[model samples]
Target: MGNQRTTTLEARVSLAQDPATTPATLYELCSDPSPEVRAAVAARPEAPAEALRPLTRDRDRTVREAVARNPSSSQANLLRLVGDADRWVRWAVAANPAVDTRIRQQMVKAQDKELRGLLAEMPDLEPDLAAVLIRDVSPEVRERLAAHTEDLDVITALLADRTVRVRKGLAINQRTTAEHRHALAGDSSPDVRAALVRALELDEADLQALVHDRSVEVRRSLATSAVTPQHIRRALESDPDETVAEDARGYQAAGEPRTAHRRPIGKRFPGRRGR
Candidate 1:
């Protein structure tokens, strides 16, 4: 019996590597006694959903993890795997886009810190689930929600969070509002201030303020913003950091003259540079 199982496992492994192997053959291998056979079948892109589902309960956690990673795994299977005993298995389920909002919400509510952490890191989490995760007990979960959710209210709320990492995530979120941007401008943490500067879609006046921020990192990010005004550029021209100042100078130079003598460099520069 041992020799027969070994031979069966080896045959399945060989079939798993062959491009011409049929899905049916791969599915059969998914139930083989050897975990190695199950893992090999799970790794095949052509492996069917039936094959993946059974492996979710495989005695070997490694084989179960392979099933969790399979792109072909059904949403039902993924939902079940989200509560798997193994941390890595739950993490893999969270990473799967097919897992539904209900499962994500359940994972967010889990008592297991590691499971909650994995759910928080999932970028495709529903907007509502993300909002809830932003208030999770785990700071790591809140930070992940802050980093990925594009919803304005959720991000705004995160901006006021005591956790520096959560605030930093909001400061860099693209959907961040001008109100949030203004708030972050005064943040005590330099990292949050710098990320805020990068995230802010500011007008001329706000850009000017950022360029003059006490934090050199904030000023450096402002100089690199594509929407930075020419007046802001000129203001940063003498900035202490030559690299940042040079970027501002480049913006200024690009705007300088398609038609220079039309107006002085000073007057025309600001209006033209933003375009």
Candidate 2:
């Protein structure tokens, strides 16, 4: 009896893998007794919608995940799997690169915060969604958006965000205008201003003002940052705070030339730049 089961499994595997297997045959195998056979069909990018659609609701979780990950899966079926009871299945749908804006909009309403966060990280995120996610309860999502989004409205809104992390992210964003830098230069949090100092150039007026900033941390940040302009570093050498002055002198002595223009490092979301 065991030998018969093994022989049947081998035949199912062979049928599933055969290059000439017809869609009709794969569709027939979709309901095969072996979960492995069904999963194999589900993973095939060429599998017909008819075959992949039913696998989206397969009893086996792995089969459902396979369908969710298949780029060729119908949008309708992918949307159905987005709401799958299992979080892993939902994650597969979220991570599929072929997911459309409509799916992303739907994901914004999902109960899972991580799904919402993944949507927030999309470089091509629609402006309407940016307006909504700006108010997301998760600060991390807001922080990620602040660092990468180029939407003017969203950037303006984040300037008022009470979270220090969000403000800090805005401070370093390449999209921040000179006016934005002026506003951040006077930010209440020393850390926020410190992050701003990492930008290659600051409005001359803002740079002069930051030279005398009350917080030593902000001055020290400007003093030690590789991107700080030469003039700013020179002024810091005379800072009232001796430690700030020492840091400025030490950094200058190292002889690393500052960039002539702004070169924002890590300013854009990964894999989304130049889009």
Q: Which numbered prediction scores highest in lDDT against the true structure?
A: 2
Q: In model 2, state the lDDT of residue 89.
A: 89
Cα RMSD for candidate 2?
11.2
C-alpha lDDT (0 to 100) for residue 175 of candidate 2:
88
Residue-level lDDT tens digits of model 2 in 163-272: 99999989988888888888999999998999989764788888889888999998999898877888889898878887897788777435557534322343445555
RMSD over all Cα atoms, model 1 = 7.7
Score each candidate by Cα lDDT. 0.73, 0.84
Once superposed on the true structure, which residue ranges of model 1 sit more than 4 Å away at CA?
A: 1-10, 16-28, 31-33, 44-50, 112-114, 121-124, 220-233, 239-275
Shift of residue 225 alpha carbon in model 2, Å: 2.6
> Model 2 clash pairs?
none
- The candidate that wins on TM-score is 2
| lDDT (tens digit, per residue) of candidate 1 on 150-191 | 677777778779999888877767777777777877788988
**lDDT score, candidate 1:** 0.73
